[model samples]
Target: MTLLAGARVFDPETGETTRADVRLDGERIAEVGPGLDGDQRVDCSGGLLIPGLIDCHVHVAFRRPEPLPRSARILEAVPVLRGLLARGITTVRDAWGADAGFKHALAQGWISGPDLLVSLRQLGPTGGLGDTWDPAAGAVDNYGDPSLPDPLFDGPDAARAAVRRMVRAGADWIKVGASGSMRAVRAGVDVRPTDAELAAVVDEAGRCGRDVLAHAHTSAAVVSAARAGARSIEHGTFLEDDAVAALANAWYVPTLSPMSDTEFAGTHRRSLRLAVEAGVRIAAGSDLAPRPHVDLTTELRLLAAVLGDAAALKAATSEAARLLRLDGDRGRIESGLRADLVLLDGTDLDVTDLPGRVRAVWHDGERAGALTSP
Candidate 1:
């Protein structure tokens, strides 16, 4: 048993802040109150504790500084995993570029990292975003960048088959492209697949008891994907006011990092504000591919500018967990939930200052001291 004494706890469920001693037993939180009895104690007198952060969209299987062997990539992922653990991100949802192999490895305690939920592979049109190959460019990948494996599909039948194939591969979720992307091989293409194909992917995922996240950028695609029952819209950078209506109950993970420099960044900011005003669910996702020891707080800082402190914090924690279906297990600082928590500098710290304020991290009720970032 361990006692985290005298720290202010932020309740993501109620968006309330209270000071308490959080007691941990085994892997769960045993109690949260002013005076919790425990065998071990840690002084958290003036620090702030919240549920461990969750990155709703990450690409754990993408290329690193250089493409190495599979074993080398796995080795490279070790420190990356450790960094995430030490930084207090206890769970991550790989939108693409990851497989069940990583999940199983992490589960078996072979690699120390956040609990990973993978999408296996991403689905798109033949020459769409996932497949950066351009026939006109003679088999060249014009994008010259790292992307998840592409499972291209043509029709509704093919879309359903692709989803089943991924589900069979132990995918926890599915991602379907609804709009053309920056790396789309085809010129002048905005929407990638037909609406029927997008809906077919959703229908098949539903049949398998899984949810599909739509990689949508345009308002048309966002609206279409929401209507087609997409669980979430990834990078809805161009989503309009009416699109928010369609996504009233669905989640919108605007991967702001990738778009912060593009021409649509302003539009994305406006869209986010509109979405918030229109009752669209906003969850934080960086869409920042792994670069050795990169800061995980990038998106949170960007999100905080649009959302106030508490809303931004919840966006990265409880809101993201709810979207990823892990809220019931670990997103709140409540009893019976996993004791994945973080200790920050102050109760009213700024988001941009979080990297320095991340004084300590806990995973599964214990401090990951050895994995602390230098």
Candidate 2:
């Protein structure tokens, strides 16, 4: 048993803070209240206690810029995984690229990494973002590993089949490129999956008990995806009034870090404001590839700019866990839940400053390694 003493606990659900002591037994929280007793006591005076941060979109196994062997590529991803844990991200939803092996390794304690909800690969039509076909070269770009699915198809029938393939490949969630890329191909945003195709993908994934996450950045794509019953829209970059109305029943994940300085930054920021005003559930996602240059802290700071500090903190904690359907097992500082928690150095810091203030972290009741600024 371990007791964390004298810390202010932040309740994500109520946006309130209270001083309490939390006791851990094995892999679960035994109790939470004032003056808890345990075999091991750790002083946590003048600190903040919050649920471990969860990143909804990350590509943990993204390959290096230069060519490398398949074995080397997998090996190189280890440091990035460790880096995420060190910076206080206890859970991550891999948008694509990470395979089931990574999750299994973490479960068995073979490697150090955040708990993973992997999508395996992204599905889309030919010539879209997931296609990677070069007509001039007469070949497709190799992703270095053949174990992952090839996410390209043409019609509704193929779309249904692709969902089954992803399920067989061990996908926890199905990721589809509903709209075009905003960076690589500006023309791609104008192109998205047809309504029929999108519906088929959602239907098949539903039958397999998996939710579909649509990569949408344009108004047309957002409306189409919402109508087709996608669980969430990945990046509503060009969301409009019509799109907001269409998303009345869905969640929005505005990945703003990569576009923070781009020309379209203000447009998406405005879209976020509209989404908030319309009562849309907003979740935080960096849409970040696990690389040396990316930062999840920057993503949280940007979200704070639009949704205030408390709301932005909820976007990454309680709200993100709800979006991933893991709120029951984690995401709160209550008893009878998994002991996934983060400790910050101060009690008076704003919730948005969590990543930078992390002093220690605990994953599944075990304290992780040395901490670092995000």
Candidate with top TM-score is: 2
Scanning candidate 1 in windows of ten residues, the lowest lDDT window is: 141-150
User: What is the C-alpha local distance difference test score of candidate 2?
Assistant: 0.85
TM-score, model 1 to reference: 0.92
Query: Per-residue lDDT for 1-374 in model 1, tens only?
Result: 99999889998757778989999998899999998888999989879998999988887666555645556655656777777777778888887766677888898988788888888677887766666565566554422323233367899999998888888878889988888775442255664788888889999999999999988888888898899999999988777767889998699998888777778789888889889888788888877474543344878888888987788889888899899888888889989999999999788647786767887888998787645543
The residue pairs found clashing in candidate 1 are none
Report per-prediction Cα RMSD to one decimal. 3.0, 1.9
Scored by Cα lDDT, where does model 1 land? 0.80
Off by over 4 Å in 2: 349-355, 371-374
For model 2, give the RMSD to the true fold.
1.9
| lDDT of candidate 2 at residue 173, scale 0 to 100 | 95
lDDT accuracy of residue 239 in candidate 1: 70
RMSD of model 1, in Å?
Answer: 3.0
Model 2, span 1-374: residue lDDT tens: 99999999988888788999999998899999997899999899989898888888888887666767777667766777787887778899889888888998888888897899988888988766677777686555567465588788789999999898889988999999888787644754345678999999999999999999989888888999998999889889989999999898888989898788789899989999999999999988888763454656677889989887768878888999999999898888899988998899888637555557888899999999974332
